[model samples]
Structures are given as structure tokens and as C-alpha cells.
Target: MARVDAAWYVTAGWALDLFQGRQTRDHDDIEIAVPAHGFPDVRRALSEFELYAIEDGLAHPLTPETLAISHQTWVREPATGLWRLDVLREPWDGNTWIFRRDSRIRLPRTRVIAYTEDGIPYAHPEIALLYKAKAVREKDEDDFAAVLPLLGPSRRNWLAKALTLVHPDHRWLEALRAGSTDTAAR
Candidate 1:
């Protein structure tokens, strides 16, 4: 059984380092986006460990307030050293900026795979990149930049499909494509 039953955007130290092709030395956290309905499962997954709350980024602002609910789950052993896992969940609505529950855009389970310590599933590369592209953070920019090249021709349809869902205005779309193109030319 999985922790959450909604679409999840999985990004963490491993994921970040993976996309960036670098080593992450710090005990960084993993971020996930989940629908409100999955809140109970998310709570159940992390109940055995410590919990912490963090504010959602302003660029990717949350509607209710500054602080977005999140929890940390971990177990440390003297010989095996400390094992830490952070899981953050917020509502996700594909049609707009914030999260709202809609069965229509709900992702299939197959699209998510085991990639992190918590056994939390992650959205496919295309879905992950779609969310990353909207982030516009420095690290996220780097991530988008890094992943786009590796995507090559395989991601053409994925890109088109995401555009239909997100429906970004022309200027932002051009900027994203231009950035991708400029990176490619280099």
C-alpha cells in the first residue's frame, strides 16, 4: 500500500542531484504534492516519526496561509547511522495554480514509481518536468535546464501534452521553449 492516493510531485535531494548530475552532501528534504483527499494516508505514512511544518514557496504560493503542512519520518540506528525521510504534501489541481480535487486529471498508479526512502511514489518524468518548469526557482531552472537536454526527441509529445493541461500563455511558453532551445544550442 502507498501513502497517498493522489497525484504526487516528487522532488528531493536524490531527485535534485539526479537531474542535476551532482552529489548532494546535505540532509536535504524531499517535496511532494498531493491532493487533500490523500491527507489521511500521508498522515498515516509519517505517524511513526517526527513532524515539521514549512511554508510553501511564494512563487508556488498556497491559498490558505504561509505555512503548508508537512511531516518528517525517520529511524536511526547506531550501526547503520541516521536515516531521514521528509514528506511534504499539498493540494494539487492541474487546471489552476493551487490544488483542488478532480477525478478527471487524476494520474494512474503506474505513472508513479518507487524512488525514495519512504517508498513514496513519484510522477513520471514528463509530469515531474511540467511542475518543475513552472517553479522558476534557481535550482528548479537548473533542473529544467538539465533535464530538457536529456529528454531529447523522446519528450516532444510529453511537452505538447503538458502544454495542453497547463495552458500557459504565449509569452511564458515562448520563454520556456527559448530557454530550452538556447540551452540546446550551447
Candidate 2:
């Protein structure tokens, strides 16, 4: 593992696995996000790894100015030619964390990141679900179902609110709302 001098957290489906303490399903790759500003440091730390920007599902070597835009990058070891992890750049600031896709959705930095007992940091369930909600795939749906039971009232409510803001007609809203009502009943 390379040392990165930046703030990063496990996000997306892998984050749910971290929260659940086990792998709920197969993941093609692991995703870790760094605050947009901190990526330069991460890039410096991972200088040994080949970096490719993923656009339209294809990987291209990053351009000199590509880092200015927010996107996911594929890290590979040039010597081994083996694809490695993904580094997602997210919108963040000193006090607040903003959803990269939706600026309207924001939360305090403290509310977005949670640490495991082992000190590994991961995105809160709501943050993970919000990202997954952008394009609801089968695995995304499964992740939501598996984590719904584990989410408490506040987390469910936060996800529900964020989904409504970013994806007003999202199918998951029905389940999220129902889950909240159910959580309150119990």
C-alpha cells in the first residue's frame, strides 16, 4: 500500500461493505475518494502507478490539465500492467462535503465520514447510497436492500431527503420513505 498525504475515504458499494463488516457481493473494483483539492497529494504519492481517466467507460491517459475536472481515474501498475483501484475525486471543503453530482446536497464533513473500529474511514451509508442512486443498477439495488435494515432513522431520512433532491422520481424513494416509516414504528 502506498502512503497518500491526503484525506480519503472509502465510498460507493465498498463503503457499504465497510459499514457491514463484510463483503455483501462481488465488486469489480474498489473505490476510494479524495477531496478534490487533496488529489494532487494523492497523485504525488501514487506517482509510481499509471493513471488513466475514465470517460464514457474507456480509459485514456490523463492529460496535463485533466485533473481540473472531477472524474474517476483508474490506477494501474505499469510494470505489471495490472489494473488496480479507482480514485474518485469528490467535492469537499474545510467544513462541508458536497455531492459531486448535485451541489444542492451538502452535509457537514463530520456527518459524511465514519471510521471503523480499526480506524479505516468510510463514507456514511447515506453518502454511499446517494452516489449509487445516480444510476441504480442491480447491485446498487441489492446494496440498498442489504443496508436498509442497518440504517437508523436519521440515516434513512437523510438518504430520503437527498434522493428526493437529486432524483425526485427515483424508484428508491418509495422504499426509503417506507423504510423510514417502518423504522419509526419499531
Candidate 3:
């Protein structure tokens, strides 16, 4: 794996684990978020790996135009056909995190991301949960359950507001409100 001196943060399930300070479960592959404009740096860093643009169940060699067509790119080792990494391209304004679903919702990169003991940056739990809101798969639900009890008031509040703005009637909003009440009770 090549390392780039660019802004990138671990996301998805692994991000939840990073916030909890431990790996809660097995992960199939690692997912990372990189600025849409900075993807070229990532590509250069991982030049040894074969990058494939994945969209609508199709995978093809990633080209400069691929960024405009797909938000995700999967990298693999050509020799062994082993998946190496999953890259998620995200909209950003310098050091700010822009919500893909709603560009109006933006936060400073510092607020939406945190660094591990080893200096690897990972998405904040609240931000990760916001992304998980759309899928609600068993794994996503499990991740929410695990991290909900651990969230502080600020994180819970931010996530609640974000959900309201983007999803409105999302069930997680109710759950987050309930969790807030529970936290207050404790």
C-alpha cells in the first residue's frame, strides 16, 4: 500500500471501529474518503494497484473521466486479483466536509474527522452514521447500535440535525432522539 501526503479519512464500518478505539467486527475491505479534486494524488500513491471504476455493477479501468462518472473506485492486485482498497470520492471545499446528499450541510474537516493513535485519520462516528442512514443494512444497524451508546451530546445532536435536514422522516432520527433522552437520564 502506498502512502500519500493528502487528506484522506477512513470511513464506513472501519471508521466506527476507529471511533470506538477498537475493531468491533471483521471487515471485508477498507473504505476511505478522499477529496474529489485530490483523487489524482491518491491514484499516484497507489499506482502499483490496478484501479477499477465501479458503477451499476460494472468495473473498468479508471480513467480521468471516471471521476465524473462514478463516486467509487475499487483497487486490486492484478496478479492475485485480490481487492486492495475502496475509494469514495467526496465533494469538499478545501478543509471542509460537504454532505454529498445536501451540499448546504458542511462542517470543518476537523469536526468531521479524527485521528487514531497511529495518526491515521478516520471519519467521526456521527458522520459515519449519517452515511449509514441510507442503507440501514444489518451491519449498518449493528454499527449504529454499537456507537450510539458511546456518542457524546454534541455528536448525537449534530447527527440528529443532519438526519432531519437530509432524510427528514428517517427512523434513525427518532432513535437518535430516544438515545439522547437515554443519555440524559444516565
- Please tell me which predicted candidate would have the highest TM-score against the true structure: 3
How does candidate 3 fare on TM-score?
Answer: 0.93
lDDT of each: 0.46, 0.83, 0.86
TM-score, cand. 2: 0.91
Using all chains and alpha carbons, the TM-scores for the candidates as numbered come to 0.51, 0.91, 0.93
Candidate 2 lDDT by residue in tens digits, 1-186: 347767788888889999999988988988998887888888888898999988778888887566554388889999999988899988886768888888988888889889889888899988998898888787887888889989887888898898888889888777787773232211
Model 2 residue 95 CA deviation (Å) reads 2.8
Off by over 4 Å in 2: 180-186
Angstrom error of the Cα, residue 48, model 1: value is: 4.5
Worst 10 residues of 3 by lDDT: 177-186
The residue ranges of model 3 lying beyond 4 angstroms of the native Cα positions read: 180-186
Error of 2 at 66 (Å): 2.2
lDDT of 1 at 177: 51
Residue pair clashes in candidate 2: none
Clashes of 2: 0
lDDT for position 31 in model 2: 92
By TM-score, the better pick of 1 and 3 is: 3
> What pairs collide in candidate 1?
92-99, 93-99
List the candidates ranked by lDDT, beginning with the highest: 3, 2, 1
Cα misplacement distance, residue 137 of candidate 1 (Å): 1.7
